[model samples]
Target: MKIPITAFEKEPLKDHCGIVAAFSTDDYPFFETGLKGLRILQTRGYDGAGFCAITKFGKTKTYKGIGMVNEVFSDGKRKNFASFPAQQWVYQVRYGTQGIVNDANVQPVLLKHRDGDWFCVAHNGQFAKDRNKREEKLSDTVLFAQELARSREASWDERIVTLLQSKRGAWSLVIATKNGLYLARDPLGIRPLTYGHLIDKKSGELIFCVASETGALEQMGVTDFFEMLPGTIARYNDQGLHILHQDKPHQTALCVFENIYIQHGAGRAHLPRKGNRQINRSPTIDDVRRKSGKILAREAPIKKSDADIIIGVPGTGIEGGMSFARAVNIPYFQAITDIWDEPYEQRTFMSAKISDIYQKVLDHFHFDAASLKDRSVVLVDDSIVRGNITKGLVYLLKKFYNVHAVHLRILCPPIDKPCHLGVNTRSAKELIAARLSGNIEKISKALGANSLAFLSVSGLKEAMYTPKNKNGFCTGCMSGEQYPINEFGEPLAHRRKKATQIFLYDNVTNPAPILL
Candidate 1:
């Protein structure tokens, strides 16, 4: 399934996967808590859902299926989940970044070591593309599991750190053993991971929950929580939480996409504190996306009369588009409407095939041709990776709807490189900005736009950054700046193509691996 860059030049960019691990002091219905946490994190991943639970009696149970969290955990399945007496739980919602979508590929990867020990893992980020070339058959999580099982380290935390140091990419992971639960983030912190607590009022006992987003913890009724520092590992057990290992971040490269599109507005993220691990003040995503819009306007203001009205793409693009319109003093209109009936509204740009993306875009959006007819329009989207939908939208407006002209504006800077941090766009060749040599006019011509401009990387940082911290986001895709821990030896595209055949090794022998 080697897709030529020309036909699939623009695939949709997807958020990284999601992970959750809960340590319960009492024999509460921990499975439901894990499911609720996964439900809140559904946005990060929708392709599949699964969970692994260990009961107080040392029995382990796991259920995984390909679909949305609710779809996978149906009413009957929920009842089954409830019947399991679990004391600790680990859950995962997966988006296939490097592996094919199948039952085995669906995660909460459980592996049984040759030594008769069992381990289960759920990961939220990606290893570097080059890291998997030699073993194209293994998914990053599965590969990490195999590597961990093979490691000689005696402690779970050391085994995890060994995996982190050996593999280079964005990994915010929760690795669970029957004994304790461990959480680790990559040194650069490209993916978000946080932990929160819900105290039992009766006994004042603490129940700790960890997830990809703080909002997921809050969904489970957690009130007090804190973000983890990059290059840190936290282990939770009967004794309570302990920071077993913490490393100084070589450079804090928190993935910007989380703030822009992945994370919900309510989640709080922060830069490293001045001298401590505690981050006192965190920025809300609502503020960051809106500020990005204002900065986009300031950086690339639309000329007067250059466009008659603004058409902001819904949900993800609207906030920035509205701010851009206001800053540019242009009339903003809700020209494009999403069809609520079409519940499967794939962000067309994220599709692997151009035809699928085009069809999805047409099905998802309907143009109000009567209002937009014969008027110049400015089209605003949050970010452009493949440029398929933007180009298609321009063609739809001008060619089909008879709009006077369409101008394209992007909120983020040009993505000229592949994201090695668990995002779906893992190859530089797939990026339109990279393909077009970063030439705006050529991109404009290709997209059939009258003109096009993008917010500069510095401008994007300015908009997203608080006055207190200027550079806290990962713009690795835009700047091609290597993160501190890239282990270069393999090719991602080659391995991704072969992933299905090799990575599903456990599916044949055991639907679930590493069952202790």
Candidate 2:
């Protein structure tokens, strides 16, 4: 079922659905748990949701749909599940933020991890260098998995571990191999992961559950919990779960977007790093909501003290505006629009490096601005990406109303560069802010917003899980800071430094641009 644009993107916040898995000895209602997790993630995704279970029959069963979990699974009641518990399953609600959103692209990208033995996997972050390697090429994940298959001669878990060690950037993934269950995160805690337990009464058996957030575990009556450390693998068995690895001090590359866009705002574990040196810091999901509101209240104070209506653009900024509205004692309002019916997701275009800002903004909404025709309004959104979409929104609002000024409040700071982490941002030409000559103020004016403000970098950091722990993210997009890759496997660098006049492709390559 379609929803309001702001509602579909959950207030236009760039969050994908969370993933959860539970393992036990006997088969149980694993599908039911997956369904519940997808339901929670439905608020985060729209392209679709899916889950896969490894049964005692050793058969893998998958349930997926393009609609909400309830809309898709409403016909199947939980009582119908076979009461076995020792199965491994993975659940995901995709917002089409990364990768492809086609039916074949919906993940837990099933693969025969060990000689035709099937393995199911789901990932939260992208592999920076891996994406570029497949650009303008067909099938990114297939090539990615194929490479993984070639690099190792071990169990699926070992292959995944080795694959991660060899690869770079933000990634937290889980796979269910025939041997057991495989779980691992990046060396730095950019994405959050956690686990808890649920006991079966009939069998007196205990099951271990892993998820992107603690909230998913909480929903399954597994309140007793522990956060999964980065680079750690927790293998589930009849003896409970085993931590095969622990969060370590390596090439730290946590994604700041986890706090700005992804994540469910659970706490994080911080592993601070300076250049290549790693140190411990508080790890917790940052909560940018209230702090952004407080900052907006201070920087861009509204005249008349309160508005007839407070409207958040949706998602991240909605929460901040709600926080701000409550503090100022004003009523919060949401302007509904229709944009969910668009045939494609903006993420699809971006992943291909296609730039179509207006369509994405229009697709993410199903709203009617007549509701705010003459009313006082404030628009809230997470962060500004390229000023194009926000400029289009300003045009749409002004066209429809004898409107008051649009007080635009963005939670995160200006995006100054392409993301070198999991996100797919290419070279310099694509970024609008990067192309600007003067200060950000000039850029905001060009976007046509009457007023605009951003949450501070310190404020964004503080909003995360905590000030210390094991969490840190790679914000290479905002600052051209790199994670320092070794001389090997640097394609873009190889093109610049070594292959100065050489360009190769499929062995029939050219030394320069091969015009089509």
Top-lDDT structure, candidate number: 1
Can you write out model 1's per-residue Cα lDDT over 1-516, one digit (the tens) per residue? 111121122334666588888887655567776788888777777678899987665667899998778778888889987857666788998887776767777889988755666778999888776632564655767777887888887767777766677666778888777668888887777787888788767657577888888778888878776777788887888888888778864547677777766776677653444333353356667677778788777766767666789878766677778888999999999999765542342333455565565565566677898888988888877777777767667777766688877777777777787665677776677788789887765666777777677777667677666666555666667643333344352323311111111000111112111101
Model 1 misplacement above 4 A:
1-12, 113-115, 128-133, 153-158, 161-167, 200-205, 269-280, 341-359, 479-516
Ten consecutive residues with minimal summed lDDT in candidate 1? 499-508
Q: Alpha-carbon error at 442 in model 2, in Å?
A: 4.0
Residue 61 lDDT (model 2):
73
TM values, all candidates:
0.84, 0.72
After TM-score superposition, the amount by which residue 292's alpha carbon in candidate 1 deviates from its true location, in angstroms, is 0.9
lDDT by candidate, in order shown? 0.71, 0.56
